[model samples]
Target: MQASEVDYLIIGAGSAGSVLAGRLSEDPGTQVTLIEAGPADRSVLIHCPAGLALMAKSRQLNWGFETVPQPGLNGRRGYQPRGKVLGGSSSINAMIYMRGHRADYDAWAAEGNAGWSYEEVLPYFKRSEHNERGADAFHGTGGPLNVMDLRSPNPFGPRFVEAAKEAGFAANPDFNGAEQEGVGLYQVTHKNGERCSAAKAYLTPNLGRPNLQVRTGALVTRIVLEGRRAVGVELLEGGQTVTLRARREVLLCAGAFQSPQLLMLSGIGPADELRRHGIAVRHELPGVGAHLHDHPDVVLVYDLPGATDLFGLSLAGAARVWRGIGEWRRQRSGMLTTNFAEAGGFIKSDAAEPIPDLQLHFVIGKLVDHGRKTVFGHGFSCHVCVLRPRSRGSLRLASADPRAAPLIDPAFLQDPDDLRRMVLGFKQMRDILNRPALARFGGRELPASASARSDAEIETFIRNHADTIYHPVGTCRMGTGALDVVDTTLRVRGIEGLRVVDASVMPSVVGGNTNAPVIMIAEKAADLIRAQA
Candidate 1:
């Protein structure tokens, strides 16, 4: 498998790449090599489900990308923490196993992607999951990724649901069920209390296969092209430039940002923009890094006095975390098993809206600045975001050098409609947070959002604090339009041997958390590729 050439030379051993490698290598005759720019996913911080909080400040396994100054956030740069590890963002994400609303995918099919409607893609989602709840019309069993309720959920999570109920939202047991509306505790990508990331689900188990080879710390610099067709790639590994030939195809699964960067770096992007970066354009695809969008979320923090169940930086909290660590080591069950965003829901910005256009994530902590800035108290936070934002953004190269981080401009809140929905979404979430069910534990609202009384005040607060909930997609969009980078089968429109099989290929960001959908994309992609082979 380590030979100079492989049948599938997959770049980026993240969510999609892991699935692609695992599925493609199921054929004993096929050779697959999965490359990751980061080190191995062997960190205790990575395996321990609760370690993500500490990962916020550590660059050890994160591509800590900061957006260019955004005009909408009063020119403040947004923080974008992408996983640089094996499972990609799924390894560092909140681990909520959410499949967006059905209509979201139906819309994709309607946009000319024939095989991407909800009913068409649902099987792939099921095929990739081993839901503890067992096989059903909407869920599957005996699959690589394990989906289950938290092993040791914080009691406050149920209270959050109750609070949402008091605010008039129904309690839904499964957000991925028939209806996406209503509050509930989220299912996580976990098995026996630990994370079941895409790597763990699809790649790690198959690493022993003679046909699958995984190389870590190998940063792919550029795709080696010949007459507009991808033949292989040139990468930097062990301080040496290495060229690996692809006998079949070169798959780009580097997620939204790097996927497009590698495409442009390889001389396939907007002609003029590539010229400015001194890259010779091999293809004039203007949509490589265009049509970028993500969920824009705002959080409200409130102190919860005398709450020992919540995570905090206090003395008592330290003692609890210490015990939780020991408990997790012995049984893989404890507070450590909890994904911080324990409870949430999909609700509408207004009744007139066709589907839920807003989503919520209630954390059993005061998640200040995505948990990078520590707040010293026992408290909880509730996040509400415009699920389908009108704002669009773009990612562009800052330099021709492959090592440089690209200029990311999410253009959050650039559309006035997104801002309007945020104001209304904020009011609805504030009402849920202030309901009687959540009042038993605590104190006043955090100063940042408490004083906002009028709609204008809420709008100001939203503009000041809102940023991505980490679902960025549509950079290498798939459609029949002129700007489409890939086609229905995810093949790059103008390239023969290159295809994007990550979140970047999503024509539109889905309605909820994106990890599950990304995995589904890779699952269906594996089938499409095999069908062709």
Candidate 2:
């Protein structure tokens, strides 16, 4: 059958893809088609904030990608769960609305990529946000995506603030404000009591527009390239093969791991790797799958028998939650509105560093291995992740089949410096928990930090327990150098009519959560595409 044609064909109905489709289709003359490998974002587990804890275990909503055994992590494969639904990870994430540090974007521009400075990109960040606190110099008010404070946080949430002050960090209400060096409650991408996924904010609203089309369960197998230009995509839908052509551009927003995997499967990666997989080399882009990295995090879990505000598996805890459901239904305010990682802050492990090298996530649950492991009892956990790391890894083709999962290696903590910073971060979290503010909650560490008194012991603990914080980037990095996969405008190097607009294009991972920054990227890319047109 002849392929259906559109002005723009987008792969992956993720944060970026959803935003792109919405923005591009705003021009009634521009026809856009978006395809998602996963199903629609309709699960109740996806919309409810409290359901996120349970959603972490829903296989149908997660891509369930795992990393290769890291020699640095005692040969344990890290568990990675990217969202498989319409909103992508944003649909399943903690919804923390962080835009990263300002210096991060300045460094991106300083690295020879023009138009990415903090000043240049700030507008885009503001453009996509609809803050509940109203419009201001730092935030936008009427944008599609909602940003608001949790309707009701756990009672222990305030204790985290007091603990941070007791631990010597200044209290700042906004992490995205003038100064980022402080402790505070996180603002989440939630409105009322529901998750404000990218699909909910962008795609769903535009579904009624005549210029846009969305297809779920459309797994793109490869980019159908003609010589050096991408013309369309070959995909499998409902056991039937289909081809969809793009009249103007083909955008790959399949994210860090799969975006590069798609490029390689379409014969656009390292020549040697492509040849080994028995695929014809269309273009040899050596940097297609290089520099894969993520924030390596360790959690300090503590038993909280005295706490009733936290979610737990105990009978009393269940009863409290049952009451919370009624409260939520009646007023849309209660413990059910909790994002779990409700209170967190940024801090510098080393005073000499220009910005905070460590980021914290205070969870009101015993989160273990992405919440896949069940630990009995009531508890609270604090997660500390190195904001940036020197270690680098890669993505490679495990099989030529597009349906096969790619071999992902994040090479977590391969650098000794990364391990050292993590040690400091771990100590910092322990210090806060030991403070009088949190001590009143009556809890003890799970792994017993009493044994981890020295650097060697802490390193051993990290190697045995560290895992991904789920922010992966740089596999299809954008820059003007040969080592970069895309240019400043996100166009793939040595290719025409093709661009990657997702976390994969980030030259380096941002300092905090990635969802907000991804939306900003698509907002900026839309203007770039329009200007060129």
Which regions of candidate 1 are displaced past 4 Å? none
lDDT of 1 by residue, 1-533 (tens): 56889988999988999999999999999999999999889988888899888888879799999899989888999999999999988888889999999999999999999999999999999999999999999999999999999999899899999989999999999999899999999999998989989999998899899999898999999999999799999999999999999988999999899999999999999999999988998999999899988999999998976687899889999999999999999999999988899999999988999999999999999899999997897999999998888888999998989999999988999999999888888899989888888887665799988999999888888889998899999999999999999999999987888899999999889999999999999999999998988
Residue 501, model 2: Cα distance from true site in angstroms:
0.4
Candidate 1 colliding pairs: none
Best by lDDT: 1
Give the winner by TM-score. Answer: 1
- lDDT per model vs. reference: 0.92, 0.91
- Candidate 2: stretches off by over 4 Å: 1-3, 448-450
- In the range 1-533, model 2's lDDT, one tens digit per residue, is 12399999999999999999999999999999999999999897888788888776788989888899899999999988898999999999999999999999999999998999999999998999999998888899889999999888787778988998999989989999788878889999998788999999999888999889899998999999999999999999999999999999999999999999999999999999999999999999999999999999998888888466777788888899899888877887888888999898999898998899999999988887778888778888999999988899999999999989999999999998899999999999889988999888788888655578798998898898899999999999999888799999999999999999999888888899999999999999999988888
